[model samples]
Target: MRVLWLSSIACNGNTHSFLNYPYMEQFLNDFEFIYHPVIDSNYSLKEIVTETIACDILLIEGSISDEFKRADVPVVDIITKYAKIVKKIVTVGTCATFGGIFRESDYKDTTGLHFVKEVKIDKFKDLLNKTISLSGCPVHPEVLVNTLYAIKKSVDLQLDNFLRPKDYFAYTVHNGCTRNEYFEYKVDNHKFGELEGCMFYDHGCQAPFTHGSCNKILWNEVNSKTRAGLPCMGCTEPTFPKSNLFGTKKNMGIPQDLPLGVGKRTYLTLAGITKAFTIDRLEKKLFDD
Candidate 1:
């Protein structure tokens, strides 16, 4: 398959994530690159982005901005050109999937390819059926590789309403976290630098409510932000990087946001039961080092 990477109003974080794909050579062997910003390619930026370029898969990164121009031509124009020819469009980050963090500046002006923050863009409405979204701040490399492999194998992927492949996004980042034990016991870490507790109750760790199997797939084959004492920040969701990212918003001791699909009363009942216990194992620090 011929794949081409396109950047809109972007920082190229997804491209960096793609470059760091663990099985780089194996992935490259399966696809032909017509043009890629970071990789050596047969075509130049101008040629690859033109209306006539052949592309089996168009991988888009970054949020679409009406103001962004490339050599006097709007990025949206290039997107229109490619969208007409590409067999399938893969929006590789939350930016191109759901108008991510970049949209905070001007949400009305920035948007994703098909749906912009859960709403569809009528201009590119025809492309919706052909689009696949892999939403993340900097998309996980494994998802990119696996999605490509699935397409190459012609395997049908179970997709969510957002057009994201369910195989990778079905589970939350909290699904395989080491801190699951702490979360289960309602033992939350009040501070930022402690590894002995869960960040869900106190910190703005939205792993339980956010989609994406970050903990299960792992980042750098080693760690995730939540595992490294940082909160999940809900990068995969439309409302990511919420105003107060370090602290969880509570209204009368109840978190403003509950876990995905969980009712507030149900959560409170479970929380109340769990909070009754002070498991010594969870409260005790493992090591000073």
Candidate 2:
């Protein structure tokens, strides 16, 4: 299948993320890459519009803009023209799938490709069947690779309400986190770079509620931001980088955000019971030779 890739209003973070795949070159062999922003294929903005690229699949990166100019052409119009001919449409990043960080500042002028502020576009109603959304700040390479493989194999994929693949989005980042023990014990990491406590309580981590397999699959194969003592940042969620990202959300000195579906009262009660036993093992350094 010939895949056409386009980007607008982005820093090419997704492209970089995909490049991190250890076997990116081998994995890409399955499909015929006709055009991409940074990879093998090359095409200009004018060429993308005029040339009849036999595109069976279309992958879009970055947020769309009805106001901004690119190569003297409106990006939204470019997307609309291509969406008409492609058999499958994939929104590759959070910006393309759900109007990410950029939309926060210029919401009225900027929006995602298929959906406008999470609302599906009327003109694209017929194209919904072909649309696939892979949302993440800089989308996971595995997700993109797996999705492409599935498409190449003609396998039927399941998707959630937002059109995200069910397999990847079914589990939250908390499902297999290293700090699960700490979370169970209600132990909170007061500062960054600690390996002994859960980050949900006081470190601004959103692994429990947000969907994605950051913990299970792991980032860079060995560590994630959380494992290194940094917060999850809730990059997978539509409302990422929630206010005061540097600080935790608290209610009366306690964490405001609970695990995915755990009730506040239940969580607090469980927290109280767990905090009673502060294991020395978790408090000590993770690595000691």
Give the winner by lDDT: 1
lDDT of 2 by residue, 1-289 (tens): 7888778777799989988888876877767777777776756657776666667788888887777555677776777777888878888888888778776655355667666545766655677888888988899988888888888787789988778898899888888787788877776755565567777877688888888888778876888777776778877766765787756788898778878888988988997887788777767676845
- Any runs in candidate 2 off by more than 4 Å, and if so which? 105-108, 116-123, 287-289
**Candidate 1 residue-wise lDDT, 66-154, digit = tens:** 78766567888888888888878899899888888877655358887776787877877888878899999999999998898888787
lDDT scores in order: 0.84, 0.78
Error of 1 at 192 (Å): 2.2
Winner by TM-score? 1
Worst 10 residues of 1 by lDDT: 46-55
Cα error, candidate 1, residue 262 (Å)? 1.5
User: What's the TM-score of each model vs. the native?
Assistant: 0.95, 0.91
Off by over 4 Å in 1: 105-108
lDDT score, residue 92, model 1? 87
Q: Which residue pairs in candidate 1 have backbone atoms (N, alpha carbon, C) closer than 3 angstroms, thus clashing?
A: none
